[model samples]
Target chain A: MYSYSDFDEAFVRSRVAQFTDQVARRLDGSLSEDEFRPLRLMNGLYLQLHAYMLRVAIPYGTLSPRQMRQLAFIADTWDKGYGHFTTRQNIQFNWPKLPDAPAILGALADVEMHAIQTSGNTVRNVTADHFAGATADEIDDPRPYAELLRQWSTDHPEFQFLPRKFKIAITGSPVTAP
Target chain B: MTKAHDIGLRMVRNAGGEPGFEVIVGGGLGRTPMIGTTVRDFLPVADLLPYVEAVLSVYNTLGRRDNKYKARIKITVHETGKAEISRMIEDRFAELRPLFGGGDQAVLADIRTAFAPPAFRDAPVAAHDAFYRADPVFRSWADTNLAAHRNAQYAIVTISLKAHGQTPGDATSDQMRIIADLAERYGHSDLRISHEQNVILPHVHKSDLPVLHAALVKAGLGTANVGLLSDIIACPGMDYCALATARSIPVAQELATHFEALKLEHDIGPLKIKISGCINACGHHHVGHIGILGLDRAGVENYQITLGGDGTETAVIGEKTGPGFAYDEIVPAIERILRAYLALRTDPGETFLQAYRRVGLGPFKTALYGEIGQKDAA
Candidate 1:
């Protein structure tokens, strides 16, 4: 699994802080629903049917045991007891409170995880075959490149405001590559 | 290769040893489902980036901006046709090719070196066989969850997230931890999340199967229903998704529970029942053997069934059955179709898809609407 460097950690921390301020502003009536909607979406927060849903990106669907444990903690402590893993290999906390979004982002930042780019029109999470490194028939692991792409696309200026969401999926195995 | 248009690009490897890709374009799924057309049948591996850049540029210029629904590359491809799209991509590629030169190959080489596969150890098969014989449940799970690995001693284990009566792709925090632990200890620290919403331990020694299965069982993740009806793929429908017109999870849960109670899934053979909350096809309902699309008809939730959709190498979009069913009528409707399949199939060897293909929709439709038709006639 890829671990966050000092730069990566600092980037996420700063973003989390920014989001925390934005969230506070929204609560304080400084930002309306329309203004806060895109901001919150870029942070992977959605005001769904019943409650706020927080989608956390699991890049290339790879997770360390420690990271998985942290997610479990987040699920147990903040949201419901379980999380819904989406088709994109991301996990969604269906019942998150509006106020807890910052806290959840902070918890994720501790584990080198974030909800950034999980939603929005920008290049979303770079997905790879869940069997990337482990599969026998694959030409290569594909995750390293997926990670590279993730870093390159995270906040790429040129693609930040594309008309639609861009999804990139990579797979080494010909049999499983969709 | 066919559905490339939907996602903008598809790379099919060239047959020769020299690494290359045959890029397909314009495949996508949604209200206007389309399979991608082959734009470049034999693009060299080195030209991947510049070529892709060309395609995206073409799409950026030509793709629809007026209607949000029609903005995908597929629609552009549909309007312009494959010939013009190909010509535009080739022209762009020609212009951009010189900028790349040969730098991308070195980068690719470095990436390949970093992605080398892990060393695997041979394990005795006797241990696995012994465990399989000792525990019937383990045997059942092994039969379904395990896939043949390149190494004789290794097996690819699919830890199903779709347990009976549960959300199709949901895992409890405890289950996730157990899977992580198993991947670390038994699976050479390798874990994968399958596109089908299952956790995969891609390199587990056969000798470690027993302990892994036991651990999974303890964590409530031991569902031996891979490829079975219970192993459904359902998107978060009305419960969570704003675009959804109907609920998918409850329907899946009910069907899974009903099948489990009957204990008929394993006997029924391989069946893929994918449920999408709407036409967005996030659940891949279009490619499921039995595809269920939830729609809003008036104020009520209506479920539409599509039969014979296959998402394999030979992908086929499922054809819709007649009218949609109400929320409560869906399970019984599914039951009727399954029963019809069971009765109409040539033998047990014939899967749901094979049976459906052979018998067509005639018998199944009759099974579903026969009572209603009779009542109306009376």
Candidate 2:
């Protein structure tokens, strides 16, 4: 439901282009695997057992129909015909090729989505009660603040690197309610 | 916070028109699983940030750094004890309290303003009832997927991602689109991703349930198995996760298919079977009613069972059920446990948990290993 501003769009597009160049460099032997590892991880790319896995963020688990259709298109075009929705509310493409990573990210950017902070030591996606606005017992919806937290934490200088990966979850419901 | 060090903090607005939080410290699951201890019954909401700072500071400074496994805050709490941690946090809170001049209230007010619920409309319930009566499939789906909403004309619908025999917590791109469309048209544009790996349409009008269900059915997303055995929670084990020692998805798929074919899922009532690839408990096997933890025993996939674990308000870690079973033997082992439960239960009204609690694990163990014991004796 949250649309990206021009700045946000520019930021993501630039990152995609940057990663595409990096992938090319890695393929051409200009950058070693060790050099490219952290860069790829920051973009939510992982070398899993069988193939490269790409995790795309579904911010606070909210998506419009347009975004959903775009994701469907990505699944059909790039990876397998389906995507695995993770426990964290993100989607994982298990069979992505290294060369297609940039294209996948560019497609995500078209829908105001990204894989940034879905991996690496920085704060992962900020999760909240999926029933934030709809629950009967909740004092308030927690997503607006979750969105605020997301904006604040995304690429924040202070938390760029940490001793461990951090996760934050918000729920407006009382302890006994859920 | 429950997994890491720091604390599992729960905040609620009290009758006195102020928010307060209950702090639980030291709870974690892995090799050394422990439920958090309640260190503070309640702390003023205003002091939350400062208190959290204090807790994190303690963990950051003193938590284990040498061994990656032992670095979580839970281990630190285990080493130092809750009382000592509480004292340290309280002392730090006192020092930090003066810095916060009640600015949190304004920020909280702004946040509350942003989260206001949408305007609800009065809708005729007769339309929903008529649809329910006309379509048996719709009726069954409504019975399982729908929950009571605050508004009389509204219902909360849970879109179960765990379709029978499919990978748990996976939604196809088309399924996702259908859910999105339903949310926009009927659910006030609100969708929720449950921790149990399901999509939720939080505020749908009762009048719209029929059309929504029809759309979901068309998309292959309508699975009337919420909280059923088929609605299993499983992690991507050996098939996907590099850290996995055994396959969790295939085991879940097999069990789901097996149970569905037997048609015993609905009769069994609400049962949570969580499967983890390993001891990390990513599938939350520690808290499942029937917890299955996969392990590699001598190059063979072995699944160990844990009974009586619950993740609700009355949380309890599951107890192990002797030696682990091989990959093929796991499903039959589960069937044996369920059969024993069906035989032992007082009535259909008694759930698996109730029966398990009433009779304890002795009979279930007998059901699982009884024939093997007799065979060995012979």
Candidate 3:
């Protein structure tokens, strides 16, 4: 439900443009595999087992209908015809190619989404109870806080180079007896 | 169920009736599973960002950087002890709190407005009632897949991605569009992806149930196994992940297909079968009712089973059964455990988890290895 502001849009589009150049450099051999690895990871591209995998963040597990449709389009047009949703509330395109990474990110930016910090050593996607706003047992929706954390953690200079990936989760509901 | 994250925050009300959090820290699964420790009894909602920052800063500085496996905040908490870590976090929080300058609070206020609840329709529930009465199939699907919404006239629908024998969490592009369409048409355009790897239409009016059910049935997304055995949570494992030791997808597929063929999942009731390809525990195998961890035993794929693990608010790490089964042997091992459960449970009302908790692991262990070992010896 949260639409991206101009600042958010500009930030994502710039990241897309920067990654596009980084990808081109890698392909042209100006950037070696070692040099390109961290650059690609910062943008949520990973060299998976069979092919390159791109993890797209679904912040707090929330998606707009338009965003969902765009993800469907990406799945059909780019990699394989499907995407795998992980336990961390993100989606993975398993067979994306190196050349298509930039375009994939660009498509994501159009929907006000990105793969930034999805796979990095820095703070990853902030997750919350999927039934945050709708469930009967909720104290308050935690997604706003999760979104705030997402904003704070994304490219935060101090946490950009943590020892390993960090995960944060919030729940608005206390456990209820079945 | 936020118990298995590096930082897990549960919304709570303090004595003054102000919204705050029960802040938990250092919880994770992987090879060494740990339930988080409550670092703060109740932290004010306004101080959340600063407190969290303090925790992370403490961990980032003191957390082991030398060993990748031991670098998590859980390991840090284990080595540093809870009291010391708590003291350091409090000290850091004292410093960080002033620096925030209410900037995070200002941003949070703006973010909160974006999460306004969808306009719910107060429609008659005649269609849903009639369908439930007339169609047993719809009734079954509705019973399993639907959760109670805050608005009584609405329901939260979890569309099963784990249709029998298919890849558990993989949704085809068409499936995505179908869900997207349903969300737009009937669910107020809000969609959620559950940690259990299912798509959720969080606010579907009861009047729209029949039409939504019809669409899902036509799309093959209408499997009525939400918390059932076939609704497995499996990691990518060796099939897609570079870190996996053995294939997880095939094992999950086999188990789902196997139980579906037996036609006993509904009867068995509420069993979580989570599989991880390696000790990394990405599948959250440590907290499953039946946890299967796949490993490379002398270059051969071997599967180890852990019993009675729970991932609920009362989280508990699972206990391993003796020895590992080979890839071909894993499915039958699961079959043995379930069959034994069927014979041993007091009544059908007893779910797999309740039964396991009641009888403990003795019966299931006997079923899995004892008879097979005797037969092999003979």
What lDDT does each candidate get? 0.80, 0.79, 0.90
- Give the least accurate 10-residue stretch of model 2 chain B, judged by summed lDDT: B1-10
lDDT of 3 at B310: 89
Model 3 misses residue B14 by how many Å?
A: 2.1
Model 3 regions more than 4 Å off: A176-178, B371-378
Ranking by lDDT: 3, 1, 2
What digit string (tens of lDDT, one per residue) describes model 3 on residues B1-378? 567788999889988888898988988999889999999989999999999999989988998889998988999998999999999999999999999999999999999899898777877998778878999999999888999888999989999999998999999999999999999999899999999999999999998998899999999999999999999999999988999999999999999998999998999888999999999999999999999999998899999999999887888899888788999999999999999999999999998888988998888878987967634523
**What DockQ results for candidate 2?**
0.43
**Candidate 2 residue runs with Cα over 4 Å from true position:** A1-21, A148-152, A156-160, A175-178, B1-7, B15-17, B46-50, B90-114, B371-378
Q: How many pairs collide in each candidate, listed in order?
A: 7, 1, 0
What digit string (tens of lDDT, one per residue) describes model 1 on residues B1-378? 234233433334566665445465666667877766768766665676677667766777777778888877777888998888889989989998898777665655555564556688864789788888989999999899988776888888999998898898888888877777887898777666667788888888898899888888888888999889998989899988888988999999999999999999998989999999898988888888999999998889999999998775566788877788999999999999999888878889999999887888777778877966634423
lDDT tens per residue, model 1, A45-114: 9988889999999888877777777888898989888888877788889999888889999999998999
Task: Give i-RMS (Å) per prediction.
Answer: 3.0, 3.0, 1.4
Best by lDDT: 3
Query: Per-residue lDDT tens digits of candidate 2, residues A78-123?
Result: 9887888776678889999998889999999988889999887666
lDDT of 3 at A166: 90
